[model samples]
Target: MIRFENVTKVYDPNARPALDAVNLEIDRGEFTFLVGASGSGKSTFLRLILKEDRATSGSVYVAGQNVANISSWRVPKLRRGIGVVFQDFRLLPQKNVFANVAFAMQVIGKSRSIIRETVPEVLKTVGLEGKERRMPHELSGGEQQRVAIARAVVNRPGILLADEPTGNLDPITSMGIMGVLDKINQNGTTVVMATHDDDIVNEMRKRVVELRNGVVVRDEARALYTSMIPVVGESRRMKDASDAEIDRAQGVQQ
Candidate 1:
């Protein structure tokens, strides 16, 4: 439900573009991972989709409309169809879990009765069912992140964008968060996550789109974090074998 055509984003005339001729398409109900080092244009790619930043050149289409063609006043409406989760878990400290999630619907002018019904259901989906009355500080890091995820999806957005979602949690906790995300994906939300955690990417074996210096170097289905192929079009069987070997080595180390 997202497409980018020769997209390039430049912040300064003297500096290099944050994204350089990047082309990508993410279909509905697909779970994809955007893996790269710092400054590899992952965040920039997301911002373009959200229209938080305008593309310096080319087009970005989300949910059938070109983001660049959307009027400024309509941006909010566009975002309502998309959910976003961040690494920091940006929960409201003063609000309890239920209120935090309900606020998302409230801001969109949803009735209190609807908010009351929806918030609890979403919290349950994120595994925070009984913790609704607790405030942000009262929850653990993973729980707080779950609250964030609940808030993001309360409106049933068509696409979910998670940027470094598990970056702050332990590996086990991160896996739990991934499980929550996977469930949401299965329920028909298209998921695009940007992450640097190799173990998580390798273990999940999802579609991976690797970026290097703002350019997409690899896009593979059921792929590992690291590519065994020195070149893009190498044998898939060889890559799978190499990934298996890497997993074994990691297991031995553990």
Candidate 2:
């Protein structure tokens, strides 16, 4: 439900583009991984999808609407259908787990009855059913992240954008978080995650879109983190469309 057509993003007129002529399409009910090194345009890709920034050139479409053309007043409406989880949990320190998740629906004007039902349901989904009253500091890192995930999905968003959701946790904890994300995808929310965790990527073997120097070098479907490929941030952009064609021919699914 997300498409980018020849998209380029340049923050400064004189500098190189953060994203250069990137073309991508993420279908509904699919989970994709945006894998790249720092400054490889992974975050920029996610931001464009979120409408946090506009592409310098080209179009960004989410859920069938061109994000560049959408009105600012409708940005919130657009975001309401999407959930976001970050590397940092970003939980409200002063609020308990239940209040943190409930706040998401409350801000959208959900009824108390709805909030009461959804908060607990989402917490349970994230495996935090009995820890509702715990403060942020009282929970472990993984638990805190679970609360953040619950908050993001409490509204039942159709798309979930996770930017390094497991970056700060241990391997075991990260696996737990990944399982939660997989479960969410199984429930039909399109999941696009940006990460550098090779173990996680290789283990999950999901669709991987590898970026290097702000360009897409590989888009491998149901692929492992193949060490045979160029290392992250070290791969140069394909010489031409033919290069990408070769990658696709090698079973790199869209």
Top TM-score model? 1
Q: Write the per-residue lDDT of candidate 1 for residues 30-129, one digit (tens) a residue.
A: 9999998788799999999999999999999998899988999999999999999999999899999999999999999999999988899999999998
Cα lDDT listed for each candidate: 0.92, 0.90
Clashes of each: 0, 0
Query: Which regions of candidate 2 are displaced past 4 Å?
Result: 227-254
lDDT by residue (1-254, candidate 2, tens digit) is: 99999999999879878999999999999999998767879999999999999999999999999999889999999999999999999999999999999999999999999898879989999999899999999999999999999999989889999999999999999999999999999999999999989999999989999887688888888876544465444344343343575577677554
Clashes of 1: 0
Clashing pairs in 2: none
* Model 1 misplacement above 4 A: 232-254
**TM-scores, one per candidate:** 0.91, 0.90
**Model 2 Cα shift for residue 221 (angstroms):** 0.6
